[model samples]
Target: MILILFFCFSFTVDQYIENGRPSADPVVVNPVMEEFDPTKKPEFIIKPRKQFADEGKVAKFKTSFEGVAQVNWERHGQLLQQNDKYKMYPALDFHYLEISSVTAEDAGSYTCIVSNDVGSDTASAVLEVFETFKPSPTPAPKKLELDVKLLDRDVLEGTQQVEFKCKFSNATTVYWLKDGRKLTENERRKMTFDGVFAMLIIKDISCLDIACYECVATSKRGEEVRTSCALTVKRDKQDCNDETGERSKAPEIVSVTPSDLSVKSGEAAMFTVNHTGDTEVKWYRGRREVEPDDRLIIDNKSGVGHFTIQNALPTDQGVYNVIVTNKWGNDSMLVRLHVEDTSIFDGRDVKISTENFEDFYILQDKVGKGRFGTVHKCIEKSSNRLWAAKIIKCKEKQKPDVRNEINIMNGLTHSKVLRLWDAYESPTGFIIVTEFVCGGELFERIVDDDFVLTESDCAHFMHQICEGVCYLHAKNIIHLDLKPENILCIAKSNNLIKIIDFGLARCLQPGDSIKVLFGTPDFIAPEVVNYDEISYATDLWSLGVICYVLLSGWAPFTGETDSETLVNVTQAKYDFDEDIFEDISELAKDFIQKLLVKNKDHRMTIQDCLKHEWLALDTVDGQIMKRLSTDKLKTFIARRKWQVPTPASSLKQSNGGGPSGKAFLNGGADHWHHSHHHRKGHMQTPRSSSYSNGQVPWKKNGNAIQAVNRMIGKFSSLSSNSSISSSSSSSPTSSSSLYSKSKQSS
Candidate 1:
């Protein structure tokens, strides 16, 4: 058996080439051998070389052999024949196979066989197909619609400005040209492209701007569409009468836009004028012609003129004019349009006619005071309207932050968020005017003697809070301090809540973060305590604390002191404690738990909280909500408030550089929670008695408010206690008077 196996191995070894290279075995004849016979055996003189081909290109493999009469070719062991795709060339010295339009599938080993009557010889070469990168025409929309509209005013001399707008549909790569020269964006020449539209605003127009301006929109396919406008810069020496088509007579205006117009921000505003005769009319913003398109529009025909502004913004406020010209003469009307901000505050249209702070009738005594200044209940003498004004001293250092807050408020608008009526600079300080919330703090309402906040009340209030907060988040405003004190009721009769006190608030850009450790200790997120990046999640954590306190009247993480509470927050050490959460629904606890997660990314978002089962009022019955136990919550709140002494420092004004805003007390420790069962009239007792009734053992200036405009690098967030005052005038001084007035108005 061993001898037979050895013989078989020797036979197999003789049939294969050693190392897969050319073999010179005695049985294989050599091409140089003079005794070689064409029918005896085949020998290779040239072996096939590896070939490479690009996709769609032709590829060829060839080899030469001696003593062979027949040549055959195969690919990957498959027999090949001459065809349209494959060509075979056989000669006495060479044999070859050709593949036309080579593809990826054509890539493989090609074997050439040279044979005689006696034996055969084989040589193989690899065919590799590669992809070629060729220049391709850019793909773009061919049928583009292009329109050019005047943006600002007509081009005048160097004094005025001009703007032209170009709009395109289904195109790309937009650029502008002036007098055939491509114009690049610069300080004076501005261009902006918003996918579908392109605008070119030119300031300081002169004779150089008199040439034609062209807007060209090009696609990657090298296709382009263009629109052009000729700007005729009229000098002061030019005859206005000639342009009007008359020598002496000029246009006479029968009517024009009002001297002043006002519109709320984010809304639309229109201006129209009634005039006589066919007069040439043009619109101008300051020295520049107001472009008739973009955000502004103008129509002058049939002796009437109309100017409309869509989505009026505060930046749109400017002095505008309409110049009417005719053969006889010309007349122009200057109109000033003011776009008021209605976001952070309300009643922006109510003009504060009085410039002096003292001009307002001090409607009541000071209701609340903080680091900013005293909260006042004042009435405008002319309108007798009520308002709440929080005055902050405008020292140079604080001016920028104060102005920033004003600017932020000016841009915000949400039902659940407070609105800024107006911000005025006074000799004493800056008066931030906001609508008076007569219902006072929701915390006060929850603990009121006769008012027990059923789960329904909590849900309603929480929904409103979510709605407002969602809007704020949409606008990129993060209310770093969200608590019961910051949440105010529209009025006693109206349970709607409005978020206030943006002192710690910040407007975030994408991927922004805060890390100054600035929130109430008990409600502060673990990330904040660890000095991690603060984000919108910080507000969510605070909201969780508010929900917990509102439902259970107990803090989830508050310790005896601020430091201890901060440690607990850092460790996320808190629990339902069974006893406190026994009456709270599982859904409510779930919502709070999700928000209170130590990991910010794991925390529930405002959108998620809004959809939580506890807040999903649409799916739940009103009866179920109303049936949720509030008696236990009420008892816990009252007992806790009376039990914990109002820290003198909590009521005392702190000059320290921390968040001196109102602290988020576990149970609204700043104010007393009156018994709901107390026998009283239709009017609820005011908070003024807390100071007089001895519930507050401290005065207003004893560091009572802890979070005061915390330092953030060079910037400071101006956090001051928001005073509950009247909405019509400025901040009223006393809450009792406002309550009385609110009851009468109701």
Candidate 2:
């Protein structure tokens, strides 16, 4: 045996050297473990201690769960791990313990045995599989919503079904809590319910139930998983007294409203504020104290506090904050107030006025005072009609300029001049609603009709004006401003002219001289230079200037410099272009020269113009130039209005110009008669109401006033005719002849 051991030791040294292992001092192993003792009994015991591992991946922890108990893994109550849990005989020794294919089921109580040649012992251990995924934590409210509409509802209102869902995802189950108590405790009838979420069925919840409400969700593992809300149940039964008794003693703000935004510096701002939960409600501005007046004002009148800021100054322009203090807490809200300068208006600046465009359109403002109001387009709501509303800015210290314009327009019943329909006043300003001419201004038509005009075209346009203005002059009204832009062409109509912008017009007595300087600079008459005195002849001078521009297609005396032009006008000197003279005639020039004299006294009277050569029955190259074919004139008006003249119309065009067999192309005889009668009336504006006194009192209060004055004017004219009839029997025949001529032409 000794000789065999020595040979074995030498062989072990040679093997270690071949394997390249560092040599160590000879150390004894648990020598019995190196070889199997076939004749002796052996035992197996699980190594280490009890084991734990994740259920899903537990098999990776160990092959057969090497633990003190030598557990045999089991799954679904069946053995799966490579371990002999079903049968293991320790008396028959086994040295190599091996296992294959482990599973979570392998984790369980197991036994191991240790045996020697004489006896064997056993040890047991238990292995457990824990979860990697933990139970969710309890969560907070994800949403916070207020039920402000509750205040408008009746008491004992059943719960508006609401769903409180927890977003604690990955959690197996969710738990709900509310107001420091778990909502899991469902009440008998009016219970807090749980389906997909937690809900409180507020059965007959009154004001007493009003409180801060929220929710939270927890997982099965006692973890919060979701958020809730800060719910407020504004109970219906809650009042100031009841709220004070049931809840904390804090003040609360209610609703507030103000009377006006504008007040005098020393005036008061009236307001009302509603409150609850406060013993007393007070008001303030910034840091300054402002108190409510009334020694007998109740402290609990609907919980509303009425306040007035007396003698409010400019410094009170900031926020007016009101604080209500109750036993619970404080509540406040801020309001803004403004003070204005009250000296801008006088009481008389405004009047109750109506617009007759559409069934009496009515409004109130500084009608004629604002800059933009100087030119306003008003729509008569009733009729869906459009009207031009002109305002004269006659602020403090300025004479009522609008009165002057209206007086001039009202006096003149002229087709060329815009018709004065009505006048009104309001705190804002004075307003005049005149005839709406959809045709636009004359300058605008010049571009629309294309450049330059033929002599016949000029004659037609200027002749219409002569007729309208002559009617005005017959009533002793002067169109102080007669610029071409003031002349508007009727939209989709004949050669009708609607003169507008009477902002500088004036009415005069026969031979009366207006000593005011106002008119378009280019159109002003020489005699109006000083505004010292100007008569009907001054208008004649401007008329002469107007006709020259129309006939020659340019002003007769235009200079590069205003000074040069004014000097020429003042000197009564001018010459037409020689080049254009061939295109004009002596008759037209003579007509213009007869009126454009420096001395107002030498200006031609309207009657003198009646028999002028150009207006007389003159033959132009054997053709009657004075007569216009009614059929052709109608076609012309229609053509300009976008109507393509059919071949049928051309047949009538061959017969000169006129309305063909269309009869009257203008307004009916009724309108002509009205004009004829108005032609006889002595017209006046509100500015001359003082002059008329009781005889012709026309006011500018409203549409009713204007209508009344127009009637009175008609009667006055009828009365005046009686005197003319007695003075001259020939006058009636002459008037009838003039009316006949207009009828035939139209």
Q: lDDT for each of the candidates?
A: 0.60, 0.44
Model 2 regions lying over 4 Å from their true place: 1-359, 362-376, 382-384, 391-394, 447-452, 510-513, 530-532, 616-746
Each candidate: RMSD: 18.6, 32.8
> What overall lDDT, based on C-alpha atoms, would model 1 receive against the true structure?
0.60
TM-score of each: 0.41, 0.35
In Å, residue 167's CA in model 1 sits off its true spot by 55
Best by TM-score: 1
How would you encode candidate 2's per-residue C-alpha lDDT over 560-621 as one tens digit per residue?
Answer: 33334444566677877776455466777888889888788888886677656665523444
Instruction: Please state the error at residue 411 of candidate 1 in Å.
Output: 2.2
User: Least lDDT summed over 10 consecutive residues: which range in candidate 1?
Assistant: 724-733
